[model samples]
Target: MGVLSNLKPTESELEILQILWEKGDCTVRDVHEILGKNKDAGYTTTLKLMQIMHEKGLVTRDTSSKTHIYKALINQQKTEQQLVTKMIDNVFNGSAARLVMQALGNHTASKEEIDSIKKYLDELGNK
Candidate 1:
């Protein structure tokens, strides 16, 4: 029971949301410019996608000014956690351990990262 239940942003929407999350409230042109630097995307395309996201409740905009500034309505951490949970359930048969093992095996963890994971696990065990 979280704010973002059943709300999955499409890959394109996620890209825009990521920009909003990182840059904070932004106009369509601001988003479009930043996104364009990465790949081939049109201003109208970014604008339409942002408008659709607003309709989906994924973002909110302040329209008092001529140039509207949009902000993500969903919490980034919660959304990411939900996505990972779904992936674990569907792709890993609900085995968190398998997911962790696979991630660790696939990506080499630095010493600091390993230590951080160990510390986090210890805290979880204590809880």
Candidate 2:
């Protein structure tokens, strides 16, 4: 698969993607207002990015009305899985165990969450 075959997003594009993922589908104005809270993004920037994203096949555009509505074309879970695999390959030499171990060592988990994780590990062991 191409690096972005599953779904690749450039750094600047992620903010808009996040909005789509969060809001389901929205107009450029809606995405701009939400992003404007965190950054100096303008309405036209949102408009241009949506157009570019539509061209990239990252999103679908509906021109059924005066205002265009944008929606993500890819599944969020699948995209995240691809991104995690790519990150593990690049930063952890593709050793998922090492990546999990590092993250486990670096972050603290609640006891309940730890128990859940152990249960999941047990389930995987059975498989």
Candidate 3:
């Protein structure tokens, strides 16, 4: 776990983190280019956000070379779990079942996804 394992990244910071998580270590320009595809984000803004993320211990910067490379320090699965747990507790009144039902109710699950859910439930029942 990272020092800031409990840290909840701001939406912009989360966007940068998603890039780092998917692409591994990246230069600020690399992230900025990808973000530009979705929104009008300046290069310096991405750099500043990445710098702030480094200060927050959410990512590490390798500065041995001229161009700095950044990588996510927090595990993606752990961060997802933390956020989901918080959402379940606060938004769903701590009811995982309600959360599941709400998600399934709103979103269309594919046959394969429904089969996977059933398999998971079967495994839980067996345990």
Best by lDDT: 1
Poorest 10 consecutive residues by lDDT, candidate 2: 1-10
Candidate 1 lDDT, 57-121, residue by residue in tens: 99999999999999999988888898899889999999999999999999999999999999999
TM-score of each: 0.89, 0.82, 0.90
Residue 58 miss distance in model 1 (angstroms): 0.4
Model 3, total clashes: 0
What are the runs in model 3 whose C-alpha is more than 4 Å off?
A: 1-6
For model 1, what is the alpha-carbon lDDT of residue 27? 94
Q: How close is candidate 3 to the true structure, as a TM-score?
A: 0.90
What candidate 2 gets wrong by more than 4 Å, as runs, is: 105-115
lDDT per residue, candidate 3, 1-127, as tens digits? 3433467798899898899999999999999999999999889899999999999889999999999999999888888787778789999999999999999999999999999999999999999
lDDT of each: 0.91, 0.85, 0.90
- Candidate 1 has its poorest 10 consecutive residues by lDDT at 1-10
* Evaluation by lDDT, superior candidate among 2 and 3: 3
Estimate the overall C-alpha local distance difference test score of candidate 3.
Answer: 0.90
lDDT of model 1 at position 17: 86
State model 1's lDDT: 0.91
